[model samples]
Target: MTSRQRSAPASILQGVEALLRPLAVFRADLHRNPELSGQERRTAERLARWLGHAGCEVFTGVGGHGVVARLRNGEGPLVLLRAELDALPVREETGLSYASTVTAARPDGRVVPVAHACGHDIHMTCLAGTAELLAANRASWRGTVLLVGQPAEETLTGAAAMLDDGLYQRFGVPDVALAQHVAPLPAGVVAHAPPGEPLTAAGAELRIVIRGRGGHGGMPHLAVDPVVVAASVVLRLRAMAVQERRPGEHVVVTVGALHAGERANVIPDSAVLEAIVRAPSLAAVDRVVEVARRVVEDECLAARCPDPPEFTVVTRVPAGISDPVAAARVRRAHLAVFGAGRVVEVPQGQASEDFPLFGADGRVPTVYWYVGSVPPAVWDRAPGAGPLEKLHSLPAAHSPKFSPDPVATLRAGITALAAGALAWLGTGPLGNGEIMSFGSLP
Candidate 1:
């Protein structure tokens, strides 16, 4: 995040500063002390504490590490705001003095370092500040506001966990849902897609194996090298797009990982390809799988392998659709708060978010938006920093070097998340309307 001296209306800057100033500490705190999915006890506690102090009823540990708060006034429309509290397995390397020093053991007995490389620290901070700002200034609207501190967003389970915990029925279903993500786009710009473009994309994983015979390295013809077969399989996978599908479709099939042989002299018996399939729509995702399966089989047959290799598709994420009406309200709020130039339009994201679970029934309209995080200075400095790291490299989101500009990122998230909730819930001034509270008074 970068800092800029924009000569704008004092009210807009004041609103953002008031919300973000206290919230920046939360970001630094969360960054210095990260927590992994399903293990956000401390994170949840922090959110609850802040929300509790803000005059809203806060409940801790709703689902795993979920925290809920609720505020009410003369009712008109109920709004739900979600904040993710999970961190990634990134070893902090950004020389930021406040980088994560937290570590924990996983179910598999492996201890991993945690960090907020994806800007969720900013998200969680924004959640608290946004809640506080809206709660404090609740005199301007009429309705109930539900603020949720969700867990497991990295693994795409937080939203589902809360709903499964009877969140909707326990208190009441919200008339609108609002969510946002900090993007790699230029800082201070709020990028939003229209009603239909989903902020939470649907995705699945695939385990594709190619098998062959082992032979001496000296004689090429004597052995059935899966390496060769796998190579052709890769080529075929790329070709499928050019040969079978129409150009410009929203589809993505990527092999994230691969594993095989060990020795220089021996021929490996098998090769494994772990892949991910993504699309804005389920039908497109299905088509991606279909193409992948066909390409694998055809390529293996062409390579004269012993038999068709084993292939499996694992469900990873459901497409996250931002409620259309909820999104519009948010967009309008952003414009009102930041003006037109700062509010940009969003396209369907190739990245996936799991917030779609809210719309699993396809009845509720969910609106998701993107907030730019890259500092204009840093971006202007690192011209090579394209949209994101190229496709798949294990070191991506988990890389220790994955640091984003914080000040700008934090402000963008705080403003967007705060304004999004305010518009959805119709929040009023500090002493006037309903506030952003979570759970039943606990």
Candidate 2:
């Protein structure tokens, strides 16, 4: 890109393409050195370093490894672009040369492999690229651009942590907040869920501990077996989702973790189960929790446990609902850049995000959208192979095999963020009115 002022739409488009190689290099660096939630020290440092170099007034360590970059042009709307800085605990299995072989210690003192299975690496790179583009092309748009590098997104606590630490009060209130996620769609395509449909549901993590009397494994009849109780709870939890929830309403109850005895000859004193519940609405999420609590407690009673099963919620992330006006505007901007054929409608996703928390208790309008990450060749070949071998066969986020095309995905992502920012903070010669057609920029 050029530091010289170029207010034309074509100029901005060209600028985004120019940053692709550099952004890919930065993204690969992140992918190779992944960090876990609440521990994104190195990740945040890298972002802060880049933003500072991009002429942004960078603030480091703003809410547990969070970084905020501010670029003030003159006077206009305050637009905030948020991206996560944390990686998942999943081990990388993609066999990519730059795949993560990093590990970090958890609060429990155990170490686990880390990888950017959920594409936070892409999110960070897009934000960085957008920041650099907007900073360099200062003549196009006028406003304050707040770039947020949020940590612990996998745990859904980063947003809340930043807010509680006075994210807006410290920086400034945003008129609009925007974020884009990289998903398993064909590369160069962007997708959005319209109003009444949301990109992600509210999510809650439930930890249940079932207590029991311990004894030799050979003498199960002599002692209460909490493992049996946990098994019952898991089955009933699934049944609650299948048989209890209201028809036409969707919810998912996944028992992601279950633990009991350590040795074959001994029964543990207590069994633990960690369940993740997701629902489109907050009320539905609460209902699932209620049903789960009832099922677990009742099962414990049936198992004749001496103590009640303890149920504790670790975290809850609200549903991410894109503002109608914001979504429409960004969609139009995306169409202008990538054309109508490249922009597609997407179904509501079951995954959860902490991005809604950036709205500051619904005080700000937020638009969170998705950018397709599947390679063009893979997407084209899927259909010829069979229906089952569709784009869905592409390794989705959170999978150990999730590996996004570096250049294609980053280009599409950077384009979406820059175009969306331009849409809201319209172009100008620092003082004139600029119009955006559906296709052309100037």
Candidate 3:
């Protein structure tokens, strides 16, 4: 590593240490007042205020509460840092002092508890700290940094919304877009996928309606039970992973929600099932969806339902693939900031992200990685002999009990992002003419 790169960590660490306390408070406030997808007005307002204070040109409402903060420093490659602004419809059960106690109604008029079970709060705070640190130390880097606060990520719609609203045309297409997600790994650690592999899986959400004939509880012979059909469909779908999948292929079919009847004695006229399917590629996702449709139809037909089941694909997103050159540069930067022991490579994950949409379908080079969030002590004491075993035992993202160790996670996250931006801006150890060559990648 160059002397400049070796010396950059000290400055980045110093800056992160100075901002840790305030950033923690900011993150806690966001955690306490979480907003659901597509309804992030208050969250956008807070992010805009923070960015404005950091001396960035703030633009709000680009695509349903998406905020863009632009920090221009002389003339260099423009880099975009993205984070999610929406929370999930889950009640907080972590028992932390800043756990969310908020509830909001969905667009369908169904009220549900809200919480940041996915660690978007941590992502936002890290982006905010990175923006502030870049603004404070402009002498170390020379480029335009775009800090994006995206909404509706949980539904896999926010990135597309922003792009359709002219995100790139308005703010200029960046040389590279950078983002990071928190995982259940040990705190103070960072991980990246192999060069050509996908960072996340391709995903689609399916909503199926099974129809039946309702009748009084006393008359058992009159009504066709859609609940029984739905249960059969669920079991069949689960079996597809083992029975239908190829030897080395990975596919996940999850039925997250099922609504059938209000009372046990009265049979409802219909049942609703909400499921999400994920695979490593779009073609695989399509195959799984087709199989799922067939399973549901056959089950309903076997049950002698009054009508065929209804299928609606709510959303579909492509897998997030990192650019080889960009990912290599960022990985080198991460290794420089946090020693070799702290930076490791992981396999492609099952969780899906819409962040790849920001890449404009490979038109722009993009880099995405993961930051460990589990506390070291907790990870060590967990019942497992190795990392993978322990990882499965811990509460993962989307779980109500999932909570990141604030201090260590925030520090590592800020450093990782700042170092990545600097690596592309031609200012850190990974800087110099070699890194700047990425601006010419086709």
Where does model 2 exceed 4 Å of error? 1-7, 383-389, 428-442
Per-residue alpha-carbon lDDT of model 3 for 317-343, expressed as tens digits?
Answer: 888889999898898887767777777
lDDT by residue (1-442, candidate 1, tens digit) is 0121111212333576655656777778888888898888888888888888877788777768899888776667777778788888777888888977788886545687888887777777777776666665555546777888889887666877888898888868777777777766667777776566566567877888898887887875887898888878777666664554556666666676676787888888888887777776777777778888988888788878886799987556777766666566677667766666677665576777777776677656666777766667655555343333311222334467766667787777777766666555434112122211111101
TM-score of each: 0.77, 0.92, 0.94
Better of 2 and 3 by TM-score: 3
Q: For residues 6-76, what per-residue lDDT tens digits would candidate 2 score against the true structure?
A: 33544776887778888888999999999999999999999999999999999988889999999999999
Count clashing residue pairs per candidate: 31, 0, 1
Can you give the lDDT of residue 131 in candidate 3? 89
lDDT of 3: 0.88
Best by lDDT: 3
Ranking 1 against 2 by TM-score, winner:
2
Number of the top TM-score candidate: 3
In the order shown, what is each candidate's alpha-carbon RMSD?
Answer: 8.3, 4.6, 4.7
Candidate 1 clash figure, as a count: 31
